[model samples]
Target: MSSNTIIEVKNLNLTKGRKKILDIEYFSLEEGEAVALIGPNGAGKSTFMQVLMLLQRPTGGELFFKGDRVDWKKPIAYRRRMAMVFQEPLLLDTTVYHNVASGLKLRGFKVDTIPARVNEWLGRLGISHLAGRQARYLSGGESQRVSLARALVLEPEVLFLDEPFVALDVPTRAALTAELARILRDTRITSVFVTHDYSEVPLLAETVTVLEQGRIIQQASPREIMTRPTSRTVASLVGVENMIPGKVVGTQDGVVFVQAGPHRIKSIAAVPVGTNVLILLRPEDIRIFKGVSRHGDNSFGGKVSELLPHNYLYKAVIDCGFPLIAFVNPEQVMGGEVLADNEITVQFSPDKVHLIGQYD
Candidate 1:
């Protein structure tokens, strides 16, 4: 480990009964960086977090912290430098203040400093008024906030959060994410967050590790993961709406020209000629125009098949020879003419398209 490296796991493997839960060859976390671990259900994300937090022992491989090998027998000392918040908040049947102060008390902090620390964290999480409230009576969001305050009040150097915002509504989740980002930025805590929500990736993660079937399939920055996924599974996980099966017709200057039926799509990504590929297009990357004007590299005529509202955005399903989805601002939907089954032109830039291997 280097000075910048906070935690490193080498060739980690874990088995439960007869099944292998995780098989991570190498993973590392850097100081003051936030990494998101994303995957489908039962993808071993939680198991990996447990290994990092020292709550579970790996069947193979070694873990290091700050260049020193972790001693399983002395897990307590290492745990003090890290904290975790589970999917559900586990609060005692006491007051919120006590729940937030329990960890510090167990560490034998001075009596005078405990209240100040607890109050500070409560305020930081925007739950100062709930200090006197009974933990059992708190709402789902409140309890989660209390759990966050409890873990953060310890001032740990590393934080492991497993879907901390899963239980909250959209607005509350957004608010908490913003607050957590600010706190982590100010404290410079190295953090690993596991989530299934792709929309939250851009808000919280600096880098993202995509896990599939108990193995890491891809690791990259959130933008890279969204725009240049390495595989079809990764492309689907990142919410790419249009993943058309195509054949690589030509390759030049590292660009792959793919032919999907009669459509020719140009991608900046490389793929060998004559090989099968999948062209990924994000819904937001498509532009809808009322007229057949040339604005992008690819243009197709389509008819609106379905219209649905998603919060402040409208999801329009268009039948452009192939079914395609586009996300536009709600204001745009309202300001433009009605999209009902009318012929329209959809255009998307070539750079916005990504190509991934077509693995059956």
Candidate 2:
């Protein structure tokens, strides 16, 4: 392990009830870096986190902490250095202050030192005013804040969040995510975050690890993971909405041109000519045009097959050779002009298109 590596794993394997769960060859977490562990249902995301948190021992392989093999003889000494918050608050049936202070008190902190630490975390998580309130009486948002205070009060060297925001309302989740982001930045605590919601990954993690079927498929920065998926399965897992079958026709000046049905798409990627590929387009990157601008390589005329109001924008399916899903802000471009069966041009920047792995 490198000097900065905080948690490292090698040949890790886990089995439960004769079923294999995790088979990680190698993985590492650097100090002060946050990683988003994400996958679809039954991808063993939780099993992997549980192993790293030391809540579940692996069936085989070694787990290293700060370059030293973990000493299982003294489990509390290692476990105490980390904290975990789950989807539910899991608060004790007690006062908010007592709930936050419970961990420290159990760990043998001096009675005099507990209040300052508990109160400090309460203030940091914005639940200080509810310090005296009973845990059960608090709202979901407040209860989660109390839970966070409970975990943060430990001053843990590493933090594990297992979908901690999953149970909160949308507004509450957003607010708490922002708050957590600030705290993570300030503290620089090594963190492992697991969430099924891909949207939440950007809010918490700097690196994104994509796992699937008891194995890690890819690990990279969020942009790279979204823009350049390692396989078609990964593309589907990451919500790649528009995947058009195409073949690479030519390459020049750092761009590859492909023929998707009648449309010729240009993407800023590298691939050998004549290579079969899937052109991945994000819904947000699709641009709607009222008329044929005829700009260049990325424009295609398609009929508006359907349109639906999605929040402040419109979700549209345009029959442009392929049924392409597009999002347009009606308030900005065509407030009253959009309707089904109307002819419109669908276009996107050449740079927005991404090519997946070479086709079989």
Candidate 3:
């Protein structure tokens, strides 16, 4: 553990009747470090946050803050040290200024200094002009800004963001994310963010903890988590489109060769020869062309079984012994021949295909 550790949870578990809600063994957050906690619905993401924020008492084990054991009886004191922003903008029926200063007033800030703190935070959040506007009249983006200003004006020791941008539109969400990133960088506050959006992890956190079925599965940096997930379950979460089962044939020239689905492909994994492995190929890594292209380190022929539009790109599923999804852009798709049931080729470099642990 680092000397700068601010929050630690040891063997924490939450059970209700015969069901387990959260079964975290051990977790720690360093001072001024921001981390993203991500999981699907009912994966204990919110439940675990409640435990850390002292909103929900754990059924077993203990929680520590700054090396001191948390006292359950003193909820108010601990709560005052941390602030939480939920998905919905839970603002009052008053003006933006009042909503931002409400928490300060309840926390017993001096009346004389309330205006200064509120105005400063509103300006910082880019909502100073909207301070006099009523909460009900504000747009979704403005309401969220008010909510953020309300949270930051308190200068709490910890900040918890629970899907704070889920309700905003695309452009608005992007703007809010940039603004939040700036605030986090400037304040260097200890924060724990929870969101189902994996892409948002890189903006706010260096570390990401993934949960599944109430169990803490993996903890690593966003890049590491995306490039090399620990398990097949985690690979799926990180957008691994192709998980081909393969058998290690031999090793040569720092590359381990594997026989997968009637084809031999090379990978950069260090697994021993004769072992079984899973080749994780993301759609973005595979290039699809109408005709066979033997240019890549690994190439295979597959029928273009499906073509689905994914925003600006097309998701094409090719049947090359097994289903292989390749990201086809406007330039990659054949000229005016973008249709299913056509013959195509999928090619990927040996280094592009990530190999995880051996498959059972």
Cα RMSD, each candidate? 2.0, 1.6, 1.8
lDDT of 3 at 55: 96
For 1-360, candidate 2 gives per-residue lDDT tens digits of: 789998999999998898889999999999999999988889999999998988888889999998889866666778988998998998999999999999999889999999999989988988888999999999999988888888889988789999998888889988999999999989998899998778777768899998888899999998888877878767777777888889999988998989988878889987889888888888898877776557566988998889888767888888988899888787633665556887888778988888875462
Cα displacement (Å) at residue 290, model 2? 0.3
| Ranking, TM-score, top scorer first | 2, 3, 1
Runs off by more than 4 Å, candidate 3: 357-360
lDDT of candidate 1 over 1-360, digit per residue (tens): 678999998998998899989999999999889999998788899889988999999998999998889999899999988888988998999999999999999888899999999999998888999899999999888999999999999888899999998888888888888888888778878899999888888878899998987899899999999998888778878888788888999978877788886678788876788988778899999988874556667887778888888667888898877788998676657767426676678888888988777773
lDDT of each: 0.87, 0.87, 0.88
**What global local distance difference test value does model 2 have?**
0.87
In model 2, which regions exceed 4 Å deviation? Answer: 332-334, 358-360
In the range 228-317, model 3's lDDT, one tens digit per residue, is 887887888788878988889999989989999889998887889988888888889887666665756788888888889887888998
What global local distance difference test value does model 1 have? 0.87
Candidate 2 local lDDT, residue 31: 92
Among the numbered candidates, top lDDT falls to: 3
